[model samples]
Target: MPAITAENQLALPRIERPGPESRPRPAWLVTTARTQLEGEGFQVRRPFPGLEVGIADPFLLLDHIGAVEYAPGEAKGAPWHPHRGFETVTYMIDGALEHHDSTGGGGYIADGATQWMTAGAGILHDEVPPAWLVQKGGLFHGVQLWVNLPASMKWSPPRYQDIGARAVTLLASFDGGALVRLIAGELGGHRGPGVTFTPITLAHVTLAPGTRLETPWRRDFNALVYALNGRGRAGEERRPFGEGQLVVFGNGDHLVVEADELQDARSPNLDVLVLGGRPIREPVVFHGPFVMNSREEIVQAIRDYHAGRMGHIPPTRMDFSHLVGEHIDQDRGGTRR
Candidate 1:
């Protein structure tokens, strides 16, 4: 196989959502489980609920948030947060999220949209529930990823991209199932959208029961899979994984996931998020959301954020003075003697 580079990568085509399969799980088998959070939100049982499964080499953190209801005027969503030395990806499965940043970038992402932001240097942003979405009160589902920036790009400029769902290409499917290739790199001979400073792959896949999906991955890159919904077996171990759980794989050249035919109708659709990247072998100094190589660098980031040197604040005229009170309480709660 040829090496995947920026110039030679193939764009994966867009695919439609597959129909439900016949062999649904037994009604008493408990197809979907529900987990609730007090201030954060709720998550429907899918791949790996809250546990961090999957490869730990290059990827740092992954959080699958919401597939649940968000009441109107709810201030329980993620408030203003800071990030540095890594890229954060927000892919929405349902509903939408309104995003605002200190860099004057603001937008609302609906279902199936993908937001890839590079916090190479430093960034402060907020992901809040939009007013229109609050009125609907439907399902608000999505996934957030933290991909470590390589040492070379750790101090690069901060950037953001909002990829519409229609723009994402679909790659060929195996065993009559389909896959959606999103940001970063490519899979199954299909390239993903969004330019990546470092070589990485992020894909959303849905497989029907009795189907098998095989992907060729770089041997040097670390890889892992998070099952969003349904049940399946992955890798050579054939470990049984349900929704809201992750399956971390050891070093390998490729990965194979097989959906069992025994899965019932309610459990016919198996959704997963795939991530892989080359590891950066360097010391990581993390303080809250800001990640840098040393404590001095982190202190510098804090200074910049306070000094108004990072970027201009958005001019939306929205009053955010109340957030200062919340930040003060958070600092007191997290402070060390």
Candidate 2:
């Protein structure tokens, strides 16, 4: 991956609403995330699979991985695992992670990179710290999202989109006081690089104090904002939010976000993730990494994994792009090629 240089910024046209839009006053839906030990002892804040289960339908879980510093050789990443019926999106803000999967696909996504893995049918994979990072330990921070696939598409062929930092669309703020990196869905009429089985809006936003953002969205999509750092106010009421807090919003045609404070040295910045998608409203039965609509399908997934139906990747280093279908070009700018 290349360094995310200033050259990656684009002065593209902003997304416009065709007509009058309703800006719903966002009422707070108190949601809490429970910390769990995941991937070889790393602490993760998980919102769903708990009281928040099925809150973000078509989106099963959101795992906010560490923003914690790790000493050399102290990082322990997830080993081999099997997933079926959904996609796993890993968005890295700091450090490096190497990934290998059962489909013979493998690669590494370092700082500012993202890996979108569609585990349709079934797939085995591993996400771990790269050898170099383990040798010279540094800060490791990122988020992983579990996106559920509709039952009809659960058995579709698996795929991947390894999006580099420079490849992500960075829509500058109207006044250049903030920026939004769209990972999936459309923002400001500019689409993200990720090709999705379901419609979704995922973005990483950085804001300077007093920066305000308003973007049109699908009225039916469920919206939420997770503060990665600093504090800010959002919506018509200007409800305040802080780091690590998740804010669920009422239905609306647009999202309103504003930054009100500077990030201190103890915090990173006013970085927040805006995620929303039309609810699938399907039966969700989860067993470990497998998410399916029925117990029968879950059984089949386990059998498929144990029977070696989902391919395998060797324990050593390898690149298996040959198994990936049509290539996705990495355009370095506001829109992906």
Candidate 3:
């Protein structure tokens, strides 16, 4: 899905309102980054819709675990849980996470890998540190995004896409100062590896100091940029966003980003994940793990889970000694593959 590109140099034009005559640059709305605990026990920063901030349609939630070193036996993950009417996309920057689902689909996503699970109708799953990693201490870092499914596709068949690090498409700048990994949808002109039921764009971007890039996007889609490391700016105001910060854009067909030149040489670049999608604009009823158009559908989902309709996961022996050192990349640095 490579699109046409001119010189790598880019600039952000003045804001223009979207109308029949012109499509303006989207402005930075607000930043909503907060720390919270999820699943069994893991601290993460969340910035996706709430009482203060409106939900970025199609993207229900985004939980980012920037980078955390885990001591042996200190890491915990999501226990067996049920989900419906949405998909869970897990992109691992470092460390390893073993996922087992009721559909008998189980696997491990190591550094730079991604696991996209569609809990269409319903499914039970558990995301836990690998048995081997739990036994031996290591670092754990990643983000889990919850994507909303339209009412029509809410009951579709559950599916999964285990995208290896190498499967992702990478685009580079002319000077090699910036790299963009397309996870879903097209970035620049390059197509991403994973696909979504609804139209959306998901990309991991890394920019060296003073690097600038503009990503084309749908004018109707809602968008946001999440800073994973270092600092950066977006839009005309050049609103600064730092690690664990989320910057939501107003409306525009292009996303402008520039890496800040900080004094610290250790983090010489900025790492960010850009996400956007055409707003479903449909009624949303979210109840815990279930997301439906109406309260009735949410109740039905709870009933379905309790009725054991979503298959069951088979038990496996706890001995993971034989699997140590498999499918892992020791150097988990860098933005993504």
Candidate 4:
């Protein structure tokens, strides 16, 4: 569920309606997410860099974190980990996650806040729920997206963008049936606050039940619609989809999704994350936390990380010892000890 909402969406600026000539992007592929344990054993639904689609170009992985509730002392999170050659965008929708960046970018991204970290050359960090959430227990629902960087800028420098919920740009569809939370990129002449090395558009869209939403999309960028919750139909053909389903759209300047006339009690509306970037189109060699252009570059990244070149773990952060002796095949997407 989206943590931010407007009492009156009508009062918000409306996204201009796509003209009749605007080509509607048709749903090319639709796939469901696979549940898997990540980090320190928290369950996540990963939809891409996946079997259905090896990669989403410029975007690597999409992890849909829990809409699940946790009991006291049952909460878990990722311990100290290293990442390189990309950016990590974590958006907290309901609960909070405290981030400890070795680069002094630590903060609490709770209730619709975003932690955008650019692991340019490399960086080490840990993400965990706050002490209160861990000890008291409560609801936790969020998303962590991995955006790939072009080879030219992969080693630029480690940077962080702490986008508070208040900083998010809220927009309404042309007919006012949807609320679009612009996390990054531009839409209908409006721009979000996120800065990116790659050209992309990222927005959390909430479609009111029984309503239809159609908006103009950048023809240059790829289009993706990920159902975070609720039921919906996508494309001109009205292909039915539900929560955890990822819809990839084909070439067009317009995008569309229609919320079901009735939705589940828990999700009264269709909420989908709409994101797509200009394809990097370069060779991708992924191994563990490292994404590089070649297997040699991936190996170099691992060696650098082990040699303390990425960043140092702070004394206060907890170490889970998760990375030792794990060797993953760069192209096979498999891990071998």
Candidate 5:
């Protein structure tokens, strides 16, 4: 788990313990994740969207990509695709990935880094392992989340944010038993680097064995806890869940997660992605790469993509014609050869 860490977690700022008035959310539902091949033959563990869309509202999908080691010539990644009316957040924990899009915004994301792409209106997108990583394969672990945009902001504008590893907010549990990395939204008066159209909170937490994490949560937002690795108990009811499992919490002021005392040596700590968002209670029609409110709107998005209404990918080769050396002829006004 290369996702940011602290040698001395006790030295980090502590998240104030939830007061007595704060009620711990109860475990409403729990399910095991399903493994499937995604994007160019890469495998992913998806835990939601299998549940009711209304339950995970404002969130369309969550794909947990490898914590798997790969040999040379075995690495894979997503190819060119189109998206509209939502945001895609790629958090790279252990390996590198190259991202580029029609908006000319992208770069390498690795080692606890994050790339947030808001395909609001529309955009052509591509993300793949770098040639170096592909040629000499190594471990890769990451998460890609699809966040839905409300109908009002669905066509605002396409934007991209490269949130470096160090930019995330880090905090510790009241007793220093857990390390909290805040990727987006607000928590205990501390805010993350990610900006969102919908109110949300995204955090990666590592809980040491036998430690319980009780954190404040917004009553307005839907709460979900997904285990990235290791076994753990969730909510006030203490529902048992393990790797690739997800827990949905009922409305409350706070939530609880406690790591099991006995964990597999493969992953010694319970690492979980804690997330919640204000539900956009509108009708959701998710078809292919488009997330819209109506079927007709989805149809329109597809037609627009085919008609090139979405942005276009830039040419691979650099254009030196605009540079100093390949200047146009002023006398004849001819094109540079």
Candidate 6:
């Protein structure tokens, strides 16, 4: 919530480039429901600790994580790590997350809270379950999205936003159904929350059975609908979409969703996340958490991490060096180096 100093903000140099029309959505990456935490140690899928869906289009990564219940004294979550040249957006539906980052920003987000962190030049952060929430033992549902920073904003100072549910505006309803507008852009005559780094739209929608919702969007930007819960039919093709599925659409000015009558109405609420943005045509050189236009920038990010230039160590004082080293080892074993 602190203001970024002029000196720090001026570090990033601007560059002019083509927008959405120049880069369209490559083939949409349809990742199946694979467990990301399990037997190796924790009770969930092993190797990968997060559920990563969607392609690295203009928006590089999207992780629908922590949408399950946690047990007492059984702590499980993501530890401290470094990131550069991208923005991480965390929207929580239930439970709470205690966050601490290298940039001296730390906070706890309750249910329906949203946190947007821009790891511009670079940042090292940690997200862990609080002791109180672990003891209570309830559901932990949320989404984490990573958007690549353009060349101009790559080195800008890191930023953070803890948005509450009340702060977001809900637009007109469809027969008792409703939509919550969050982040940049508009839907159904209602604008969204947060600053506009790029021309983008992020919305959380809930629809009842037999209800239909229509929203306008830019024709040039690539759009996609991710089903969070329930079953529904989208677009003219009437594609059948279920929970935990991503539906990418071709060029269009709007998106539509119609609920199925046969589907169970006991849990008639369908949670669908709509996200799209103008694509970046520049070459994306990715290595683990850092994403840049060139490999040289990736190397510089690594050097910055080792040199302690990102920021001060997290206040929790937890040493995350071992876990990070193990991750690097695994990536190397898989020929990712």
TM-score top scorer? 4
lDDT by residue for model 6 (297-333), tens: 8788878877888775554555765565455445321
Model 3 per-residue lDDT tens digits across residues 142-202: 9899888998999899998999887877676544566777788866566787979988989
Please estimate how well model 3 matches the true structure, expressed as its whole-model Cα lDDT: 0.73
Query: How would you encode candidate 2's per-residue C-alpha lDDT over 25-68 as one tens digit per residue?
Result: 47466455778776556788776545455567878878887788
Colliding pairs, model 5:
none
lDDT of 1 by residue, 1-337 (tens): 0101123123444332223321211111112223434223433233322233323535665666665666665534555656678887888887778888877775877767888888888776777777777665666777777777877888898899988776776564543454545555877566767788877888887667766666677667766777777888876566677677666666555776767667656456677787777767767665656667788887887777677666644656246634633552454322100
Off by over 4 Å in 1: 1-55, 73-75, 264-267, 328-337
TM-score per prediction, in order, is 0.80, 0.87, 0.84, 0.94, 0.93, 0.80
The window of 10 residues in a row where model 6 has the poorest summed lDDT is 1-10
User: lDDT values of the candidates?
Assistant: 0.63, 0.75, 0.73, 0.85, 0.86, 0.63
User: lDDT by residue for model 4 over 1-337, one digit each (tens)?
Assistant: 6478888999999999888889899999899998988765789888887744333888888899889899998788876777889999999999999887778787999988999999999888878889899999999999999898999999988999999988999999988999999999998899999998999999999999988888888877888999999999999999999999999999999998999999999999999999988888888877777888998998798789779898886666534444432322222353110
Q: Give stretches of model 3 more than 4 Å off.
A: 1-24, 51-55, 263-266, 317-337
Off by over 4 Å in 5: 317-337
Q: What is the C-alpha local distance difference test score of candidate 4?
A: 0.85
Choose 3 or 4, whichever is better by TM-score: 4
Q: Which residue pairs does candidate 2 place in steric collision?
A: 15-188
**Candidate 4 local Cα displacement, residue 78, angstroms:** 0.6
RMSD of 2: 7.7
Per-model C-alpha RMSD: 8.2, 7.7, 8.2, 2.6, 8.9, 9.4
Error of 1 at 106 (Å): 3.0
Please give the range of 10 consecutive residues that has the lowest summed lDDT in model 3. Answer: 328-337
Query: What does the lDDT read for residue 94 in candidate 1?
Result: 74
